[model samples]
Target chain A: MEMITSAQNSKVKNANKLKKKRDRDKTGQALIEGYHLIEEAYQSTVKIKQLFVVDVERLDEELMTYAEEVFEINLKVAESLSGTVTPQGFFAVIEKPVPETTQAKQVLLVDCIQDPGNLGTLIRTADAAGLDLIVLEKGTADPYQDKVLRASQGSVFHIPIITQELSEFIDHFEGNVYGTALENALPYQQIPSQDNFALLLGNEGEGVNADLLNKTTQNLTIPIYGKAESLNVAIAGSIVMYHLKG
Target chain B: MEMITSAQNSKVKNANKLKKKRDRDKTGQALIEGYHLIEEAYQSTVKIKQLFVVDVERLDEELMTYAEEVFEINLKVAESLSGTVTPQGFFAVIEKPVPETTQAKQVLLVDCIQDPGNLGTLIRTADAAGLDLIVLEKGTADPYQDKVLRASQGSVFHIPIITQELSEFIDHFEGNVYGTALENALPYQQIPSQDNFALLLGNEGEGVNADLLNKTTQNLTIPIYGKAESLNVAIAGSIVMYHLKG
Candidate 1:
């Protein structure tokens, strides 16, 4: 096994750059840390470009066989490539999967969600609700960001998430386009559940873009019976997604 | 207006100490930052022991009038007391509200939820869903922590959250005790929506504790139809809380 003892080693340096969205975009690859996430990626058949592990003997046999290239990295190199305070000692550089082109019957349209944790939890919730795809508006946080990935708990590997102009997507969407809003909207329960639909959730401070809300086939709201101004975007989105899926 | 130019001012130092859970517990006071949260505390009738602001002129007149002691703080003092990168220039040291003595009809029982964000969001969601109260088990994250307070978006002020033993509470409870579990649990929708119920949510990794699960009137689960292993605790809790409140 090749050993990467220096943080400045060419492969280690390149993998470190993949932490940024711009670098991930330019190279079509992203770095993921920890054994659980890497295992999820492997199980999902995402291409593993390279693997870095502190202990070669402890590496999962299947991952060992499947990795295109494996390097034994010291604590220093692992720390450089890790996003977390405590490096998990296992990291992988994997090719971002190509988005499936098929028109999804059930979709979650995320509109400019700025919080990475909320965005990631929404993705995970959508996956659990069996949504076919997640369409993120341009301003939404990058799904591959470390916080987002960790919050998604590897559901990012299980679900298809793509970035696109939400307005254009809604224009072409054939099924029920349910937009959540505080005003001029029916209670979410009043809307009949449908087999094919797109649930639109908006930014935390500002709601669904006005133009996009206008394009939605129906707008709905979960009634706030108490003094809270509103529900968190991820929480609101999850409830409606599950309701729609039913 | 009295000015506090130094971070070492006795009052400023004491307020800073309230940032830690142990100190907050000992003093029965917690420091909350940002304008919105402070306003919420004021509206909730929580006792404000002291108010710290960068500019007295910019402070809301009502908050200024209501605060027991108002101190004008400089940027250095503000930065030292703030939890976020950019300080909002408003801070308050508030006494924890006494738990309401009356029994709540709709309750949220949280068991060992370790994440501050999850715990906070649950509080916010319960408030929005019109749940009467939130009962936290011993191992759950401290609701007064900065991360929890911020994630809660001031909903902590809108609801009563008290820590109590789940087993004892369930034993004396009058209505249905719904424990969320993956095994031997009915689909959440299968249960009839009832006004008086206690919804139990557990840790992120572990489902409801086995002993607690056995004590519930009914164990329920939100269906997961995709490759994702489970729903996030807050998400699952919100869905059920809203359902039971319907």
Candidate 2:
């Protein structure tokens, strides 16, 4: 395997930047970590920029077939390139091309959920519900961030994603927009889950803003039976997607 | 605000332990940061071993009433006490009391979810669904660990949680047991989501072990309509909880 000891190596420096949200934002690229995540990136048919595989001999022959260019790096070298402890012994630098968000027949809108893991999972759930696009309004975590990408399991590659001015985008689509609220809203299941709908979710701490709520066609809430103040944003979004689909 | 800067100080040392999973496990304590999370911990009526508010005057009057013993720690002191990014000017040392896990007719069994955030969200969802109790088998992330505790948002304090051998616990649970899977499982919505049934979940990556599959009375999966290979495990668990409750 080729040795990469110098932390100053250009590739190493770029991979490390992915750990922070700001660098990820400025570069418009994400570092995909772990074997499965990188595999999913390839399987999604997203263009691969560079693949850094540690212990290259251990990689399955099938995965190697998809690599445009593969770099063999030792575990120590990979660790220097990792954002997490126990780096999956490998990572990839994928150019984050803004996805081609299709015309919204049915869509999903996410307010600034802030937590990287939560946002990623919401995108995964949205893709599963067969929603057309995910719009990341202000205050949301970087979807292309390494943690968010890993949480999404490469669904970001397949799903159409757009992060832009929310009000302008919502005004353009104007379909049946439903937002989840804690109280004073009809039960999501009771509301009759719709097909061509854009499910909007707000930040974990605050529900959607009044201005945004005024824009929604309807305000809906998942009934909470127990003592919990609310559900995790990701879980809430997923449950809403399921009920609204059926 | 009382400023204590020495890392060797008793409180500072205790809070620093929270950064490591091992120390948090050994002490049976989690150092919760931020006014919002700490306030939620109090509002939930969870017992706190100690309250470390960085700015006492900044706290809402309602919250100040709850801290029986509030220590005002300075920002520099708070930074050394903080487990995460620039301390939110607040911290708390909460005794991770093991909840009294009642043997009910139903429960949620976690096999081995490794992500602390996912585990915490699951516990929160379990509480929301009004499940009987939560049982975490070995290999699961420690529920009392700081990250999981934060994610639970005091739901850990509200719910009855237990950790033990999976095979042994399921062997005695006296109701219908369902596990999440891909092919063999019933559709989540199709099954009669029972309030008195136990739900089982597996590791995020490897999934449920083959041997454990025999122990479950039934297997269920949230049907995916789009391109994702699988839904996030925590979402999968929460969706099943909602369906079972319905």
Candidate 3:
């Protein structure tokens, strides 16, 4: 274990750069904060590159045992390195896992979901529904964003998330792609259950992209019964994902 | 129309105090920001007590005609009074509607849901599912909190949300009360559909209070298919609500 007291330390500065999407992409390393998330990541195959801590006493033996390297940093440095309002004394830099091809039939393909919280919730929901994979199009919010990680409740560590262009994914995917949209869509209940299917969702404001929607085998809609114009994107996605998990 | 330049004006000071829970409760009035929410409130039966705007030109004729009173304030004053990071130039003080007895068959009972965004999302989901009402237990986040309102996306204006003790609500409610928990609960799919039912959701950390759970007609669980510990409270509530909306 190394003690890092200075915020100006070269390692600390480099690790902090993982906060940006470009840096994370370039290095294939993302920072996961909080004791819980770090512990989850520690249990996963994703390699932990480094661990930073304000106090080692707060960490469990399992995390310490699994960690590749540990650094004890001062509170000032910890605060500067932290992303959340309440820092939980531990952060891990983990190598982003290589995107794995999905073998299972049920999948969720998300297109242009810009909200971090929505994207995180969708990932968590997909995990809970027993879906095999979640495919994100290029325009979706970064899954590595701190708010996304926090909102996901550590599901990011569990779920297999892959990012690629929606058009290519839809064309290459083996299952029937069911797109979600408001107009010219069958009520979600009316769509016949399939043994192999992919659920596609879109941005918060716009429905699924027109060209993408046309490419899907069918489009589905969750009926809004009350004065509410529509359900929040995450909630709508969850409702549909759970219903179609059959 | 009234033009107020001073933030220290008596009405402005009184309106500002509504930001606090105690003051909102005492006054039975809460501020709703943004053109969309204000417009929703204007269309609803709920009385608008006062409307504040930095730009009179942005106010629609219908809103101006419907508002009980309108105040034009300086941009500096508007910014100072705004709750959101990006203020939408319009704010309204709306009288809290009196709690009415629910007439429909479906209801949602939330117990001690502490996250404002979760509570709001749950309410919005309930609205989308055509639930008759939302009963918030005392420990739940205040429905009128700015974050809650923003998260609800104006559903709060449409949904009938009432606060009362959970014990009393369960005892008096006409429909079957279905509680959600992780253990010793039937998978939500296995639970029989009810003609009239209330879905009960609990806090983020602790599940439903045991005493309240005991009083419920049945306990339901959404099975976790992956390594994720659990779904976000709002997402979990939504899946159950939509599934059981039979």
The candidate that wins on DockQ is 1
Angstrom error of the Cα, residue A76, model 1: value is 1.4
Distance from true location, Cα of A154 in model 1, Å: 1.3
Residue-by-residue lDDT tens digits, candidate 1, B1-246: 899999999999999898888998898899998988988899999999899999777898888889899999999999999999999889999998877767899999999999999999999999988888899899889999999999898999989989899999999989999999999999998888888999999988887889999999999999999989888899999988887876
Model 3 lDDT tens row, B127-154 = 8888888888988899999889888888
Query: Which one wins by DockQ: 1 or 3?
Result: 1
lDDT of 3 by residue, A1-246 (tens): 689998899888988899999999999999889877787777776798889998888877777777788899888778878987778768889998776775858888889899999998888888888888888888789999888988787788787888888899888888789999999899987766566889999999997899999999999988888888888889988888877764
What is candidate 2's lDDT per residue for B1-246, written digit by digit as tens?
Answer: 355656677877877777777887787777787776777678767667777766677877766666555677767777787667866868777766667656675588999999998899999898888776888888899886767877888788777888888888878878888888897888877887565788889998888876778888888878888888888888988988887788
Best by lDDT: 1
Model 2 off-target regions past 4 Å?
Answer: A1-31, A53-80, A89-91, A97-101, A172-175, B1-5, B10-49, B56-80, B89-106, B209-211
Ranked by TM-score from best down, the candidates are 1, 3, 2
Q: Give Cα distance to truth, residue A40, candidate 1, Å.
A: 0.6
* Model 3 steric clash pairs: none
Q: Please give the DockQ score of every candidate, comma-separated.
A: 0.85, 0.63, 0.81
**Candidate 3 to truth, TM:** 0.97
RMSD of 2: 3.9
Q: Which ranges of candidate 3 are over 4 A from the true structure?
A: none
